[model samples]
Target: MSVAGEGAGVDTGTYRHAMGRLAKGVAVLTTTAGAQDHALTANSLTSVSLEPVLLLVCVETDARFHDAARESGVFGVSILAADQRALAAWFATPGRPLPGQMDRAPHHRAESGVALLDGCLATLECDVRDIHPAGDHSIFVGAVRAARLAADPKAALVHFRGQYSALT
Candidate 1:
């Protein structure tokens, strides 16, 4: 372990240390506002409730999806399969051109008209119910309108320490 503020280590050590201890599952968040569709890779998603089918996804304040989520008022979460490292990377890249960018990814419309990735382990269509302000991020509370799981079991893609990996 490195000490801080005594010429022992860099200031970035704390951030790296914190990330090192966290293990997260990767998911692609998709939303369409008007005629524009937006998708971003995210790991900050969690199930908030089972009784009413609620989920929470955090979006960075500056992310393209942040405003899209608010305007669209609906979104889809696609839990990426283990083999989808390329998809995860493609969505996570910053400043990529957007028109028909993800056309190659197999997708279908959910009940809410949100584009859901076809080969994912699971997909959830949700309506934005509440928005909470978190530091540097917005926590979106969504009520699940529809959900589906793949018929065949598949390993999940995971993200940790800024790397994409597979759950064993």
Candidate 2:
């Protein structure tokens, strides 16, 4: 077993464990194709540009959210508040039945038909501008179609060391 602070190991297990230490803001990525909706817990969101308003999200290529988002050509990202850990966990769980998967949480539909979970600190709806395959995931570059930022200050739910933490 490698101890903490040990030499950097490039293996998959070692790389994953090392990345776990990096704190990332939590967000639920939502998408819909036709009559069905899909969502997944993702922390790979990053702001790429402000001019023209652009952002990116990395989704596992095999994830259900991926296909829906790809086919729909749009996606929604709801930045989770610290108090919304339960909702985050719910979407992250695999094998959860669909058609009513989003029923557990109250949400509203964006203009693009993507569902944005209510009570989030921030939300963004984007149209997929570009897609790049990266390893086992796809990097989706989105052009911000609509966005909302919470007016009041609040804590954000974060993920670190493979666990969720409220960063106050």
Candidate 3:
């Protein structure tokens, strides 16, 4: 069985192209694993519930940061500002170490010891409560422990059609 309509095989390129049309706010997801910090550029974060303040983030199963976030049981989501395109690119690059990425941009540690990007439009520190396996990714459902908005909330970094955009 394939994960496509009517049992048809899903074309990877087509799926990527179709998904690219959906505009979404960019966020840098971060977590600390042991002595190392891990981060990834993500746009797949969304709220799941309000009473318990549950949210979910999708992480590729093969990504290095996936294990780090799973092991730590905590993650921080920094909603990127329009001017933070470079920071997003740095985190999205494969084989880029967290230290090297930090050299390009600075971040702070939350009370939970999760790495948080500075100058973001908003931030959320979450504690993982459950994980569900998706096709090629794992959906991590978490409870929001803390959240804050940036001092400047003028513009938000958005991604659409495979490019970075600003929604001011």
Candidate number with greatest lDDT: 2
Give the Cα-based TM-score of candidate 3 against the true structure: 0.93
lDDT of 3 by residue, 1-168 (tens): 345475268787898999999999999998888878888999999999999899999999999989998999999999999999999998999987566566677788899998788899999999989999987899999899999998768689999999999999
lDDT of 2 at 49: 96
Lowest summed lDDT across 10 adjacent residues in model 3 is found at 1-10
Q: Name the lDDT value of residue 153 in candidate 1.
A: 57
Q: Looking at candidate 3, what is the lDDT of residue 81?
A: 95
lDDT of model number 2: 0.92
lDDT of 1 by residue, 1-23 (tens): 33455544546688777876698
Candidate 1 yields a Cα-based lDDT of 0.88
Q: Give the TM-score of candidate 1.
A: 0.89
Ranking by TM-score: 3, 2, 1
In candidate 2, stretches whose alpha carbon ends up further than 4 angstroms from where it belongs are: 1-9
Residue 133 lDDT in candidate 2: 88
